[model samples]
Target chain A: MNTNNSGHSVDIVEVTKTFANVTAVHKVSLNIRKGEFMTLLGPSGCGKTTLLNMVAGFETQTSGAIRIDGKDISDVPPFMRETGMVFQSYALFPHMNVFDNIAFGLRMRKLPAKEIKAEVERALDMMKLSGMEGRRVRQLSGGQQQRIALARAIVIRPKVLLLDEPLSALDKNLRLQMQVELKELHQKTGLTTIFVTHDQGEALSLSDRVVVMSRGEVQQVSAPIELYTQPANGFVASFIGEINALPKARCQKSGQDFRFEVCPEISLNGRQPARLELKDGQMVHIFIRPEHIEIAGPRHNGANIVKGNVAAHIYQGTHTQTRVNVPGIGLVELRTKGAAAIDQAPLGSEIALSVPLDEAVILPA
Target chain B: MWRQTLFWVIVSCILFYMTIPAIVVVMTSFNPGEILSFPPNGFSLRWYEKALTYPDFRGAFRTGLIVALISSTLALVIGTSFAFLVVRYVFPGKNLLEGILSSPLIIPHFTTGFGFLLLGAHLNLNQTLTIIIMTHVVLVLPFVARAVYVSLLNIDPNFERSAANLGASPFMVLSRITVPLIIPGMAGGWLVASILSLTEFSASLYVTASRTQTLPVAMYNYIREYTDPTVAAVSALLIIATMLILMAANHFLGLRKILAIDSH
Candidate 1:
């Protein structure tokens, strides 16, 4: 922890992983900067875990190369890769106590007993597991076990830290708490980290940049805000957060501005990046976040407005999800802060909603 | 109530049926009379003294000890390694290899002894101690393999992966993790093979020269020639030896855990 190290950079160059007849990871390439917390986010079977394993040297890539800090380590074994891993199951050695578990890597390096003790104690204090080192792993609770797993990995001060859904097993409250601690740990150590998880919230909240994957291929890679505001494709737009997909919307170019005929009665203004290639009458999918649409009132006239009857108002703790059934547009869900939607627009009542042009994206269908 | 009573009665009857001869042998060993009998006329240690002093008794006892110790040690090493290989790897003919290893448990000892006798003769090593050791090793292999295999099945593959991830070499992982975890099962198998080899009569009879008779074969020959209490005295001593071995095994690795009753 005291070393004058800026952490290692990992470069995955067109790595592919296949198992027997099934290809788990398509040709994928990524460069993780030094001291960056990059997360691989995807659904199950999307090759996120496979990609992480290849970097950790647990799973060999079928083709292509992986380099750490400008050195090729594709042929290195897991133990010699110098990557610390926190497994999904925690995978704590049941036979060893917390102290021994954390001391294992140092011992493998053949460190002196005095140094191993000091390092293990430092890790215990860092993880807030100071006095619990003497206790067996099975006696600790799930959160404590996870803490020990983290402590064990980081005590060695590895070149890169690999976490495979490490906090997925904890309860909801503990998961949020651990998420904050994990972020704090990353900040304190500044270790180059690669986290693999399927939960979008964990990915968005914890990562410096999230790589969204689907069907064994990368869908998009961007910072959390950019990824949410501007998704590269339909899948990324819908997967990151709750989004209303208006499919088969035909785009019409009116001079410079793009208008999309989302429905028979609704012609919505489409907002996209300046360099995007758009053509008239092109079939495209329009994505709008639930919170992006606001309830229209008098003197608040907007560019694109649609009328719909409130189908259902589901009150969440922080906001109410209002499902509106629009004519020729099917059902569109909108998120209104607090209890405003339920009180303002009751069930089966006509409500006018405005969709801002900049808040939505029109992608090729 | 009737079913419970019937079950208890059936269990008691089976126990008595199995233990009656053993009880008779123990009782007759202490009898003052020259002939073996269940009810003793007077309690005496004369038969024990005579049995200990009998010709060739000490030599046969030594032979039994040597063969049991060597065969069980060989079986424990080879069988446990074989069990680990079968449990951990997927290779062609795995099922066939397992079948062949475990077939000895179901095959009759005398038939196995006869098979080994012919093989030993063909190799021109019929009466050597190496043949006895080799035959006994195969005879006890099935028990050791099955016991260790059961224990190996309880281990998770993640443990090995975790060990390797922690920087342990393959040999270190096996010695420090896998072997220590399966010690109870190994001890159980070792004890069983040792006991079986000690009492093995038919196999020893087929392979052993007259000068190298095991205790059981010696007892068999003595019983055929004599009608005294000396055989009973030897049997009683062997029963005590078995009990001592069991107690020692229980002390080292609790017998219940080794037997898989409480392995978890």
Candidate 2:
């Protein structure tokens, strides 16, 4: 047995998976760095989980190759792939207790009893389940069962660890706690983890790099902050966070600067007419974060200012959200910190709105 | 509440109806009078001793045990493999294959016996123990296959896939995971098949040789040739033996587990 201190990277090359007439995953090529926590993030039926299964050799690629440590393993069965997978449902052996669950892989490898006991105990300790060695998996809480699953997978000391929506079954608080534990566990073990989840927040929070996919195709692959700040397209941006999308017809451009054409009925200073060249006559979307738009101050010269009536105002304890009705623009949301006064800003009251041009993102038609 | 009451009433009626004949058989077997009768003057163990001394009775009992054991074991092996194929693999004419395997259950036993007799004649296997065993296996195969197949279908294929992914070979998954999980269903099917083979009469009548006369066939011949209380005694003994075997099976492997598999 080769006991090398350095870990190996997983390289998936143009892998595609098709079941009968339906294609689950299209040609997806991605190189996961050694010891990096990479998440495949997409909605249901987006093939993110399928991609993870292909890496683990649970599902074979219809076409293309997969390699671990730079050697082709597309034809290798799951048992010979040396990859550990934690399923979404945990899939712990119902007949086995915590100790046996963790020791199963070691036993399969025919390791000595003393060594298996030591490894199982160490795994239980790593998962903070030291004294839970004898408990049946069904008896454990959801979070504890999830930890047992992790312990079972990691105890095998696999070169690659594949997690398919591991935290999805846990309650929100436990999910968050496991997220931190998983990150720390990955850092300590450096096992080249490949995780799959539909939740963008999970991907952004836990991954070293996030691969965003849609309709069985990869949209973008980048660091979490880059994916958040500099999204490759509208799909990634909308899926990642809430954004107010407005028609680009309501926006004008000057050299490199752009402005919105607020309703003509509403009076505003320093507002320019939308540029003809920028308006392709087709509907284009402009996304602005709710926090980027502010209630204008009197006597302040603000760019892109709109005079509108408050259609509705909701006080949300920490922040107050108001929907202002501009004549042609319908309703635009404005979020402000610090609770607004209970008697302040009644519905249909006139107010001036200002949005910084830099904060608005122009999306393709 | 009314429905539950009605269900219990019907169940009690059916249970009473089924037990009446068994009660008569036991009562008649212990009759003090020389003749088998519904109401006995007094109880005695003389008929049991007389039934034991008869060579034909002892030989037939031994034959039934051998046939039932061999046939049930053979059926279990074949039926379980058929179930595994139907559950795990996709092939052409799968539905047709399933129908053929399960067809024995629908066919009349007399027709099956006559067909087997013809086949045995063609194969020069007339009146042989091998022929009787083979026919018995065929008679009970559908029950075993259907029971085990249903259990295999209810199990998630992902369990096996998950096992394979965790470094278990296909054989390892079958032996360690799949087989252990399905053993309850297999045992239930095997028990039913064994009981069926033990009491088999119509097929055994045609296929069994003089040296291989099973208990049921031997009892039929004894009743036809001689009108005596010894036949009732032997019938009672067979029923008691069957109940003992069933109790032993239930004690070792839970009846609840087997019934649960059938329910699913």
Candidate 3:
């Protein structure tokens, strides 16, 4: 909203990218505010990386424009774009030591030797890699190499930092560690970052605003919580996290609530979304999170309750995922924190489940 | 255990059979007499002295060194540029160009030499160093280019894009990133080309003049002239030199990388 933020904003206007025969990215328009960590979240072949490459000037858009800080860089080459991209492989120059790798950009700019040294030192210090300057990239561990790659990119003070699945190469623990470092790095340098990742959990944890994409189209763009709680359509709901998609059901309108009738004769009184104008028997899809499906207790006669036999129990360290097979409603999964659900809902035992859609995403089938 | 032992014995025997000729040549270089005999009666350095001092041998060595240096350098430049073109771009006649350029590796050496000889004669370059050097370059080009091409393929393309993203011009990215990474391949290719050029005989016989003859051609001519150990002495020295060069290259560049051999 302010001039300071607008000064560094990136405005992508109807950007479309195509390969020889395939349209990789459809017309996607989004505005990224300054200093915001915006992430493009999608599955593989969803055009997130292609979109990032277009912004970085590695690939030019077939149509439309990409403006970085209000300057259209469609005709500008990659080197002149002033955008720093950390590649998926880290792409550290294997021939050079860490010092030279970090100083490469400065050398390309023909900076004075003294200033270059100071800048390299500051960057190394910032990444907590001050002593690793003389080490070969092959000698360093994966996490260390990742930090050095970041140091190399940020040392240039690029207009916008583009991260192309940089954390995807690391192990789970290292990935978590780097995610924190990435968040802190974003805060420290206030560089508007456009991150592309297929990991939905990472997208949820990292981004200030998440753009959910599917099949080269932007499905929804909102805050991570809003993306989960209020998905614009069916694709965004199924993508953002673990969700149990209920089978097609006819909607029966009550005064304020809507009842979804299934063959098993279970009434579902869920909040009717404004986008869906329901007649008497209009089919609608119901999506509920694994955590939302709770086990029914005694003295529970709710309309959304259904009976299903527990099919499987997968005990994760933090939470247990239970798969329930309902005859007419198909299979629905439930998540319960800790190992309680594994014993509470025994396999092959009939258990009543309360499928709540009060806070869930309900869309037209 | 018996079968394994027998298999290894047979393998060693076959290897020894293949190496017997080289061993005989090396042993004959130390023979004191004019005619070579197995397990020489007396060791002498006279043949080596004679081989090193002979005017034709000396001249041929000098000419071979010049031809190897110039031809290998030319091959490295042409081969690397060809590799860059073939690997980076797809155009009309790409396959045809590749096939024609790499044909020397498959075509009979004498045929290629004869073709070059005729071409040189047409150009009024007969019996000249230029003709010999041109033949050597053409013969060794496929090897050098293949090495550089493998190196280029192994290079992550992101290295260049990353360099470009960091404010490097197209030339700067190439000079700083791409060139440095492929130096080992270039060195390996140059070494192989030079060694091959120095020792090439079949092709040199057709293209090289008497004055511009390489070491291998001169040795062949000497063999036809007299039954002496002088050619044997020269062959021994060349074998040792080649072994040393290969050992040095392996130590420095990990020849497996240049050869595109996976260790596992």
Q: What is candidate 1's lDDT per residue for A14-85, written digit by digit as tens?
A: 989999989999999999999999999999999999898888777899998999998999888877888888
Better model by DockQ, 1 or 2? 2
lDDT (10s digit) by residue, model 1, range B1-264: 999999999999999999998999999999988776768788999989988998778889988889999999999999988998899899999999999898887788887888888999999988788888888998999999888998789776656666667777777778766787677778889998999999998878898887878899899988888888989999999999999998887775654443332323
Best by TM-score: 3
| Candidate 2 Cα deviation (angstroms), residue B228 | 4.2
DockQ, ranked from best to worst: 3, 2, 1
Among all candidates shown, the one with the greatest DockQ: 3
Q: Of the pair 2 and 3, which is ahead by lDDT? A: 3
Can you give the lDDT of residue A204 in candidate 1? 94
Cand 2, B chain, TM: 0.90
Q: In candidate 2, what are the lDDT values of residues B111-150, reduced to their tens digit?
A: 7888888999999987788888889999999988887897
Query: Where does model 3 sit among the CAPRI classes?
Result: medium
lDDT values for all models:
0.87, 0.81, 0.88
**What TM-score number comes out for model 2?**
0.88
DockQ (Cα-based) per candidate?
Answer: 0.31, 0.39, 0.63
RMSD of each: 3.8, 4.1, 2.6
